[model samples]
Target: MNQFNKTINRLGTYCTQWDFVKDRFGKDDVLPFTISDMDISTSPEILLALQKRVDHGIFGYTRWNHPDFKNAIISWYQKRFDCPIQDSWIAYTPSVIYGIVKVLSVYNPQKKPICFITPCYDGFMKILSSNDYPTKTVHQSLDNGVYNLDWNELETALSQSKVFLLCNPNNPNGYVWSVEDLTKIIELCKKHKVIIVSDDIHMDFVYKPALFTPIIKVAQKMDYLDNVVIITSSAKTFNLSSLGGAYIICPNITKLAEYVYLLGNKDSLSSAPALFITSLITGYTQSEAWTDELIEYCHQNLIFVKEYLEKHLPTLSVTIPEGTYFAWVDCSKLGIPMSEIQDKLLNIGKVAIMDGDRYEESAPFLRMIIACPRSKVEDGLKRLVKSLL
Candidate 1:
């Protein structure tokens, strides 16, 4: 009778996580747990809203300037995180990475290496590398599975860096940044005159006892309004990534202008997609309970991963995540080299999990995405253990 137990066939849907497994991992036959997007269904409410929009029959150029779009964003932050942002402060982007790259190009036109914590998102790493931007990382330390930043190292990196990039409730392993953590990061970045670029897309999936604090909320009181910016979307929150809607909240007037200019004039992506805007408003305004259920299901999936690995594959280790649906498993105990782990997994285990080094993590690990049905979670775990054997 569990609502989340329902399975949906995802293959033949051009799903990157399912159909493009061979394109990414060189193995088409394997079950994939590499991409961070969900395998679970989005809110039925959102699907219905999109259908209504489709039925309207006019797919003309859609503008996101309406009050509803901004109000939905404003109310979501206010209700969920107690954050209040001006409607005028919000601007649209095609995706989070699109916003980040625009900010980087405008803010750090010199392309100097930006700084962020280690075991970072592979997407960020790939983007930085693709732009030939040198990056400096201060590897996070662990205190009972919670990722802790080395403050001294962070300060040192910030002192020399132009930007401090963050994926709040960081990916790979889900470490929700406490308010204290956010405060300290803001203080260090402000002290060094560096900008904080945070990707807050995964904020909604945090479990209880661990709150997702947006860096913008923490910096709202500070004098450095121009130094903080966050790019996020309902895409990650509502399984609407394929729909293509993202936005930026910048307190800096000048940089915000530049971002809009880059997006509208330079990139010529002025019009927002109608379906994406509909999805955003509907998901934020109407589908909150759906999000709550999603959090519960994902948290349970992570716990299952931790316990299942401890029981069946003692050599593998996973700590239950505090946020997001990902389980970053430590496979160093298996004595498999980073280079050969995926080969073994694909050929032997018939599983496709991302290698930790792609995120520049120090030790050997595998990042498994578990935002799917319980059956897939169980089957994927069994496959992971088989790969190791």
Candidate 2:
């Protein structure tokens, strides 16, 4: 068995994924597959690094300007994606969402509308809504189980919008954007003079043959890097979301400085914890093998899900994800209401999965997190079969 197959007990760690399911759904026996975080243990190198930090016992204010941290990020990008990132272009933020919020605030001085592909990360819509920023959601059309960008719609939306928030290797559906598609997007954004903020936290989760083209790479290739900013972290790749450290990579030095200036003025912005920075460095530098194994394991889980659904639940269809551990299962064929599906899964099936409508309202889908032990995934599938079949 792979190390990722070992089920670490996360019940009492205040882990919202497992521990809070009972309170949230009023059920003690529910097996939660919601939330993007993994149930697997973190990389051993990360654990050792944290151990060393704890042994020191001095949790003082740490600077984000550490050469080790920046160098690790720089090396990881260059090695993994063949993308070049500079130290000066990087700026730290507490999380990807926080970085995005700062970008919106800094760029949209007139508060012009923001646009993004729909069935996206729900947080993007929520954050924009909370800030009273109007948004144009360009829903991706599904063709033969793969989602593609509607170029005409996107161009139109970009023409009217001030900012375009992109989710490369998009959340929920897990479609890794191709370089060609990304190039077209960059060209369109350039034509419309729209600023691009790409949330690429899922870049590393892509499956084989489906490359994750970072926006910066595409922009650099086109020599139009001035308008793009990338928000990413070790959080998703290493399951370190709780540790709280994400960074923004802005190619334009002047715009990067503006973001730094605005973020500096915010009294509420807190620096990442020492442990988080240590984990980032360890993950970027020494966790490549562990990550590769984890992705392979997840690919097997993806295959298992595709096969199981085809055999046991022939009426339903699943979008075979090119990236990420999520299986976005389409239940529209059943003609059941989304709420009823959620109710049955939570109460009858005793399995916790995210309602698909949360990503796009009225979409007959359920997002299942498959980054757990195979036994656990089998259990969830069995429960799903019992509830819906």
Candidate 3:
């Protein structure tokens, strides 16, 4: 086990995933695989940077003109994904969800619709719902063990909508869209005049043999640069999500600048720790060997979970994930209603997996976060198997 592998009993130390769930499930103890955050601690380099910022003791307002911050990001993209990104296109925001809301509010469709893929992050639906904006979905196609996009359905939906939201390496299914596939999506969107907001938050966690192809890269090559908007964060990769730093990389310089001037609120200035975390993007570039090791560990953890379920709980099945540490388990075999399954999992199994109802099209599949210590994953699955048995 790597150093980050250990039981998280100190979870009561302000961990919302652990503490907040007690009241929700009416149990003092519940294994929380529900929330998207990992139980694994942040990288030690990230912790040291955060602690340094704390040690400074000022906590003053911060800005993002730092060359190192920008360079780190640039280097990360260039070195890791081989996607060269210009420093000028980066737009700052506290969170991608909030950024999406802001973009929707500004783009403010009157008759045109704002669309989200079904069984998405759920938070995306909530954001649009709270604003009472009409939306549409492109249901995913499940063939045997893999999930894929329904191009005809997607084309149809885009033909009717103005703004389309895309989750690269999708949430529940972990389906990483290929460049060719993303090209099709962009072609459809362009035909319909749909502006694409691509959330690549999970871009950094892609497992090999399933490389992540950013929509920006595809759009640039297709010269549809004006049609795409990329939203990404170090939060997901670095586990500094709570530190609140998100960015939008757009090539429509004139429009993006206009946006900056119009809505350049205090939120645009990323926090010190957030900037620091961005600085640590260099670590990934510099520590490819280390990242390779982590990726190997994650791959092993995924294999362990799949094999355990297949061997011990043959009835339960998980779609072997292509990206992200989340395992989308089809609980339909349990013969339980989606909500009822969630309740039993949390209250009886004492294991908290994300509910399927959130992803409307993929209802009855629990989203299990496997980005934790191997032991925790094993124990959680053991509890899961026992409860189901």
Candidate 4:
């Protein structure tokens, strides 16, 4: 009954999430459930807008401060997330990951190690190691399928570490940190002289009844705004990762501006696709109907996954995702080593899922991307369960 079905094509699209891992798994046909992006077709309005821009036939260089581009982003953030912003705080980067790297390079950590909560995104470790920065991880507790932050442990890490890289609505686990929790974390950081690096790229995909609270907002209220640096982008929400439009949100405008100038900023210019996405996101922000529907659909998908697991794979515990479309399934009951389970999934079931050990200390867990269509989710789950059996 959905009108969005016509544009959903698995062919001719060249999705790295699905295509790239096919041969690696030694599968003739891969049922990849690895990456986070949804298999569902993008919003028609977004595609049309991008197409129209392409039809214009002018592919000239564009600036990030273009009136429409800047206004679109500003208007969208204010309307969607209640993140009030000044024009001066917005600085463009090629990607959110790139912005994170800049924070590592610019911030003088001295002797203090950078701390991130463990069972985190695997790439963060790679980033830290690549930069040669020492990292200390605070492991979260596993309670009733939900991952809970050990506040005391977190504080201990923050006290010793200089930079705390926080993932809001945290990745792999999908636990949305409450405002009160964030306030406490900021207070601890303030007490410890810790600089906060908040990655809030998944802020927009939050399901209702659970809100995505920006750490910066809480930091600002606590007069700890100067200690915070936020990196976010519309790429994840708008399905425009290739567009390469992202911003670093920090209140110390003069510091960032001087830093950019010092670095001889070369790639700050936004592209045509970025402009198109900004325009598309502007409309989406103004009209919540699409996002509302999307959230509802995602929540239903989560419910479906939970119910499916309970009935078929009773031993596999899954945390009902508070935000984002990822379901972290605890696979300890199967008695197989994490590597063996991953191998079985790829070779036997033709399924490619993210291994648990990648998140650090989550060895018996399986991260499933539940962002695809319900039919695809069902197929993946069936294949996974069959592989386990």
Q: lDDT winner among the candidates?
A: 2
TM-score of 2: 0.97
C-alpha RMSD (angstroms) for model 4: 2.3
Please tell me which predicted candidate would have the highest TM-score against the true structure.
2
Higher-lDDT candidate among 2 and 4? 2
- The TM-score obtained by model 4 is 0.92
Model 1, position 239: C-alpha lDDT score: 86
Question: Which is superior by lDDT, 1 or 4?
Answer: 1
State the lDDT at 339 in candidate 4.
Answer: 86
TM-scores of the candidates are 0.96, 0.97, 0.93, 0.92
lDDT of 3 at 154: 78
Q: Residue 271 in candidate 2 has what lDDT?
A: 58
Model 2 bad stretches (over 4 Å): 23-26, 268-270
lDDT (CA) for every model shown? 0.86, 0.87, 0.74, 0.75
Model 1 scores what on Cα lDDT?
0.86
lDDT of 3 by residue, 64-126 (tens): 656766677787788778888888887676678867776665555473677767778888888
Q: Model 1, range 181-217, lDDT digits (tens) per residue?
A: 8888888888888889998888998999888887888
lDDT of 4 by residue, 1-389 (tens): 65422335565567677667665455547688776677765565666776777788876676565555556667767777687766777666666787788766666446358999988887789888888888889888567765677788888888888899998878888878889888888889889998888888887778878888888778879998877888887766666675666777777776667546533445544343445444445545453566667777778878888899899988888878788778888888888798888887877778888887878855598888877778888888998888887
